[model samples]
Structures are given as C-alpha cells and as structure tokens.
Target: MTDGEGWFVVNACESRWRDDGTLGSYCTFEGKRRFPHFGININVLGPGEALGMYHRENAQEAFLVLAGECTLIVEGKRRPLATWDFFYCAPGTEHVIVATSEQNAIVLAVGARGRGVGGGVVYRVSKEAARHGASVERETTSSAEAYAEAHADLPRSRWVPYREGWLPSDR
Candidate 1:
C-alpha cells in the first residue's frame, strides 16, 4: 500500500504467517500493489523463541519491542531489550533476537527494501555463538600502532571499513 494510504491498521490476529512461523502483516501496499517502497510489520513470537539469523541484502531495519523482553546480539554483544525498547541494525551487522519471557513477545519492525540505499541489516544469535557465529574483533591499539598495521603498499593511515548505508546522507 502507498505510505499515504491512510495508515492501514491491522490487529495482530488479522495478519498472515509464513510457513516458518512469522506473523507478517504488510503495509497497505504489499503484493496488493505492483511495486511498493518498502515493507513494515508487527511481529508476535511466543516465549522461549526467536527469529533466526538471516541477512537482508537490500534493506535496513529497526526492531522495537512493545511487550515482553528479548536479548539482542549485535556483532557479539548481548543486550537486553524490554517494552518500548529499540535497536537499529545496519546491513550486514549480523544479529539475532530471542524472546526470554514465558509470555509472548511483541515487536514492531520497520524496514525498507532497497540496496545499500536502504542500509545494512543483519542479526546475530543472542546466546548461541554457534548459531550466531563469529564476531568482529575490537583491539586496543595506539594510533602509531594502528598506522603501522596498514599495508606497506597503502598510505600509512587507519581507516575503518566502510559499510555502504549506515548513516543518513544528510547526517
């Protein structure tokens, strides 16, 4: 549906679920329209559960928990998030969400479908290193040490790897 389409409101009970068990309710313009800007949805996952690790090739997303609690592992750090809590994941960040409460967990996720134009969005498993896999290393190094680590052929400088869409253009 068009973003301007009077905010297509839907109750959790009214949405459809994928075979994998995610209740997916689309914005007013899902497949009902030819081409839409992006997709938005509110997901409800039962207790002792989670949404696994999978990367979005062309989208950036933010998950906001409305009820219950969950552990979010982003690049290897586990952070607990409760109601009204939020997390924004840049594409390829590698992350995951696990519902820790016995009661159902409710989350609102807003995302856009576009390449780096949208940004990085990845999920890591909250507790399982195997499920979440390896992580990036952050070492303590002095500026001179960091500079010396640069490739011999390259200029002597320390530059962070650029992930295409982590920040808004104007920012």
Candidate 2:
C-alpha cells in the first residue's frame, strides 16, 4: 500500500512470502518491488532448518537474529546466536545460519547485490554446515551445482501468504 506521496510502506504481514518446506521461508520485500544496490529479506526457520547453502560472496552481507535462536556456521566455525545478536560478514566470509532453537526463528538478512567489480560467489563445504544440510559435497563456485537437487523431494520456494506469527505483535 502507498500513501499519496512518492514513498510507500509495507507491513511484513501484508507482504509476500517465499516458502520452501524443508529449508523454511522468507519475505524478500521484492515481489513487485525491485531493490537496487542491495537486497533484504526476513527469513523464518523452524528447528533444524537453514536458510541456504554454505557460501561466500564478494559482496558484503549481514544478519540480525530478531527472535528465537540460531547457530551461525562461518568459515567452518560454529557460534550460537540469540535474539538481537548481530552478525557481520565481510566480503568472502563463508557462512550460513541454522535454526537451533525449539521455536521458529526470525532472521533479518541484508546483502550487497550484483557481482560486478570483483563480485562473485563461491560455494564452500563445511562439516558444521553440512550437519545442518547446508553444505555442498565439494567446494564449487556454481550456485546451480550447489543447490540443484539440494532438496529434490521437498518443494522448491514459491510465493505464499505472509505468515503472521513472525511479527512482534503476534509473538
């Protein structure tokens, strides 16, 4: 929804969600709206679920654990994160977040967009990330190879309704 002005606002509950049954879901805030320079998303993960594969990008990235708990596997190391814990990854820092709490977790992810000017991604293998089903068998730079058949039996991500419980009011 938009006001009479040039800028607009959207509540998460009123946004669209991209859901992948096994890995969990997210509201990318980019359905009809395209964000230049950077991309952001609100990821929702249930216990034992992860947001994506283990990888490092030349573009900087960060994540805020908004609620519940998570385990951050970065460069083969493991660190537990709680609500309000902020994680920053400089360019080329391989990482992935996994839900470690009993309840569903909410993570706010923000990352620089575009692979131009030394921008690229490298999928890395991590024993820590692999336990969570987030690592590739071998180190590879191709996202397609790393994610293809990642969860063949599970449904791929598709737009769904903005799940209400993720909002603070519903918590």
Candidate 3:
C-alpha cells in the first residue's frame, strides 16, 4: 500500500520471494518499479547459500544478521556473524555473506544505489567468497559473468509472485 507520492509499506512476509539463483531467496517490498534509489531487502539463505557475488561498489552497503548464522567474507577474511550482528561495507570494500549454520539465515540488507556507469560495482575473484559460490572467476563489472553458473544478473532479478511458506520455520 502507498500513502502520498513517496511512501509505502508491506509486511516482509507478504512480499514476494525473489530467487536470485545461488543468492537464494529474498524480497524487497517493491513491486515492478524502476529499481529503488535506496535499496533494501531481506535475504533468506539456506545453508551454503550466499547473499551474492563477492564484490565492492562505489556505494556503501550495510547488513544485519536478523536470524541464524552466516560467514561474512570481506576482502578475503571470513568472520562469523549471528543474530543481531551488523556489518557495514564502505565504498569499494568487497564482501559477501554465506549461511553457515545447519539451518537457515535471515539477513536484512540495505545499500545506497549507484549510478549505472563508471564502476558503480566490480566483481572480484576471491577464494574466501568461493567457499559458498559467491565469487567470480575473473575480476569484472559484469553481473552476468560473475553469476553465470547460477544464471543471475541483478537487472533481471527482483520481485515475483508470492509463494506460501517461503520462509521456513527455525529447526
């Protein structure tokens, strides 16, 4: 629902679960609009699933481990993060999050959108990110190349029709 020209709200559970291949399932309470200037989403990651390619961007990004455990791989370092843990990625700082617990992990991600040209983002080939299939084999700015194995490209990944029980209960 919307109120005024610039405000809206939707329950996280009511939003559709967008599956971005190896990135697993997620949702950004937006429907069919030009990608929001400020992006936000809740990622539902199964064990071994990752948030996305290990890459840095010209824009800053932040994440919160809302539930479950995940390994945060940043610039080749692996750090464990659990519920309530928050992480910040400064401009040009490479990072990726991978669920490491036996169950699942829920991460709330927010980032400032960058313009579409001149290195808004760059994918990196990191052994640490590869642990969960979140790294590219070659350093490039192409999302398609970085996620070729999983058939994902940000331009084409977003909201979809909702599915029942998209979020599994904690085990």
The candidate scoring highest on lDDT is 2
TM-score of candidate 3 relative to the true fold: 0.85
Residue-level lDDT tens digits of model 1 in 51-130: 53423334567889878888776666678889999898765565667667766676777766655532333322233533
For every candidate in turn, the CA RMSD to the true structure comes to: 15.6, 2.7, 3.5
Comparing 1 with 2 on lDDT, the higher-scoring candidate is: 2
Instruction: For candidate 2, write residues 1-171 as lDDT tens digits.
Output: 332435667877777788877778888766565676788888989999887899999899989999999999998999999999999999989899999999999999999898675449888889989899999999887766788757677766688887677666752
Error of 2 at 51 (Å): 1.8
Q: Count the backbone clashes (under 3 Å) in each candidate.
A: 13, 0, 0
Could you tell which candidate, 1 or 2, scores higher by TM-score? 2
lDDT of 1 at 44: 55
**TM-scores of the models, in the order given:** 0.55, 0.90, 0.85
lDDT of 3 by residue, 1-171 (tens): 232367666777776568765577888776666355778888888889898889989998899998889999998999999999999889989899999998779899999876468648899889988767888888988876777776633456655665555555421
Best by TM-score: 2
TM-score of predicted structure 2: 0.90
